[model samples]
Target: MGTWEAVRRGRLLIALLVAAAAIPPASSAAATTLPKKAKASSPPELLSELPVHAGRLVPSSVVFPIYGDVYPHGLYYVVMNIGDPSKPYFLDVDTGSDLTWLQCDAPCVSCSKGPHPWYRPKKSKLVPSGDPLCAALHSGIAQGENSGQCDYEIQYEDRGSSLGVLLYDAFSLRLTNSTRASPILAVGCGYDQQSAVQDASAPTDGVLGLGTGKVSVLSQLSNQGVTKNVVGHCLSGKGGGYLFFGDDLVPSSRMTWAPMSRIGFRNYYSPGPAKLYWGTQSLGAKQIEVVLDTGSTFTYFESHPYQAFLSAVKSDLSKTPLIEEFDDSALPVCWKGQKPFKSVSDVKKYFKTLALDFVKGKRALLELSPENYLIITKHGNACLGILNGSEAGLRNLNVIGDISLQDHMVVYDNEKQHIGWVRAACNRLPNADDHGLEDGDLSQYASMGVLK
Candidate 1:
């Protein structure tokens, strides 16, 4: 499934501790053989002393698998090297899903086994017996050596799951030429996983969440001082983008700043808001709130605003014939006839720019034209990436998912308690002497009222 569709369809595997209400009891939800936990917190949250930093960028290689064009663009995969021999593992890069887990050699009831050999922690020096840190990760009742290891279970809304032991291990960011090392970070050694889609040969090892969740790989790195608690990703609409850690990834001077805020946790781990104004004709003249989520695959809104957005968008396309019955897209809304246009390039001119407007009238405009959110499928049909959030089970908030984030440098700055973005052609942005937008201008966004 496409990343956006995955979020809507609920094809997710969020950690049990991160979203306990969404999952089952840790013991009953996972393998029956190993020790179980009545409840569990992510390893990073359990950590009292954060690890030290080496100061480097961890580059994980990503591959965009082709889901149907009807679906939003596909999800990316991360390849990491683990263990003493540094075996390679293919996993998904999910920003909202935390816990870096891998399919283990232990055992499984109904999981599709990957081609790579399962990682056996016995040989690795990363986790030793009687370590308090590992004990802190313990779940259910602690058994003995082979069993007392920290247990973790992640159950998805769709009923798929990965339950297993947790491990702190050496990980390498797989890069060309040379590999960068990392201090031991928390990783879920998932031995058993239930796959919604079969063909064991095809399943990704596990997910690597690069989100704000405390246990997330991004947070783990930051807590350890490898980099500041900052993360950024630039996904290209055409394909191929980069994910980075640390200030050196992009110079602060080159970025345009905007205040990014989150409502006090829960109501779904967290709901983020971005104030903006969108319109073409008489519609979209008022300010709107969209939830910033990498977990969601597309943009969405309530029925009222959806109609406004649709009408506003339709008013501008005088030349393009929009086919309403686009069966190719998994999204609720899609159109065709804009193609003879492979990709969205040909139809981009007719689309509009979406602006991020603040209280002081300071605006950060993002071009959400076809080049950004429209997917021209292999079937030659053009699919609009934005959908109705209400139909997708989002009630109180509109979503600004990955599709809308394409081609932009989005920065998640937890240290300064701010977030910002700027449009850039390259995934690897150039360093700037003066980083960030003017502080006073950013205050406009910082001061806007939050939705939640």
Candidate 2:
């Protein structure tokens, strides 16, 4: 599906902070005296893999931290360095969308107050035409309105678009051993933008597409022989998570693999008959077209099945001592006032964990903890992060957004067409395969501690 049809509308809140934990500053001597040519000309290095399994060779790697916000449940972003004398940029990471691009200095009437100044291609010092990886990129690029410079255009679902050009620059990846390296590739630089593309609140520097399309950044790298076409991410409920490129499996995490059916129309992955589970009870539905999307902030199910699920939840909540009601207009399924919660943490006390059961030899995944589905609002109310999704024109389809997929390592393997997951604490550098969890026995995985 195109980004316009795939993504939900709304601007992610402008993130002003950086996510990397301990990046050593490039020496001032190198920053000042080093020729821009040397910095731009150095052969990009493939990243070293974080060893997890027995003797699995990982040649190239790229690691970036994704950050999330609490209130509006904004989208996640990662820090990527580009250009000569490399400057860091915060890009919203998405697996559903196509084409990776950044806001640049072509010409602008209005633009979001980005985390950093726009990337100037003139000073970037890399020729886009000569890069072997950019050969395909040069074709799609069109000229700007008045300026004849090479330009690219991206249109989104919510009437958003970013216009720019293909620029060749060094894409820096921080290695696991505390060293930095870069791989020169074709990266987009947007000069003009409109609507959600330039959201001031979540003024993202750009977007990094991890999509399965040929035009995507991951596809470009794979074609250039830099890395494999595999992606894994573990978005935490609180915000941020672990993300890695290639099959750099960590020892602490265990994953269950399900083959992705190429028979589907969309470019994304999904499991067949993905039924919803409340503890041991299976709340079956017609069909759950699960789009493992990181673009949206909340989980969305179609109305027919979603409404039934909501009723079951309300009936379950009725068993608890009813709380005094207040204005609870912020969310689709919400409860407010002092009736149930002393704070947001008390939500898990009443709610049961939900599992997604996929058909196959694969396991039923328990990805959504209470904190992942229950969002705390500014009005001291607990709002459900799950929505009807009618506005997005999703009619019998369910979107497995970032919220519901939190604290679980989701691997999208294009080579094997395998989609897998395992429950994880996420913040730690865990390398465990699906070691502890039982895929065959449903009764084995009881819900963990309450949200409180």
Q: Which candidate gets the maximum TM-score versus the true structure?
A: 2
**Where is model 2 poorest over a 10-residue stretch in terms of lDDT?**
443-452
TM-score per model over all chains: 0.71, 0.73
- Give candidate 2's error at residue 14 in angstroms: 18
Write model 2 residue lDDT over 1-452, tens digit each, in one string. 11221223333221111111211112343223221232222224444333334655334545566665433546777777777677878787777665677876644433566778877665244323323333334332322222212234556544466655555676766543333445566666665567643344334688877767665677766665555787888776666665677665533336777767542444555654577777676676565767677766677777766776777778788877635245655554577655545445766788788777776536756457677777766556677778876655555557777777777778887777778888777664453224332231212211110000
lDDT of each: 0.51, 0.57
Runs in model 2 deviating more than 4 A are 1-58, 70-73, 123-151, 177-180, 196-199, 250-253, 262-265, 322-330, 337-344, 432-452
Per-residue C-alpha lDDT of model 1 across residues 241-303, encoded as one tens digit per residue: 555565544554656655555544421222233344344343345555554555545666766
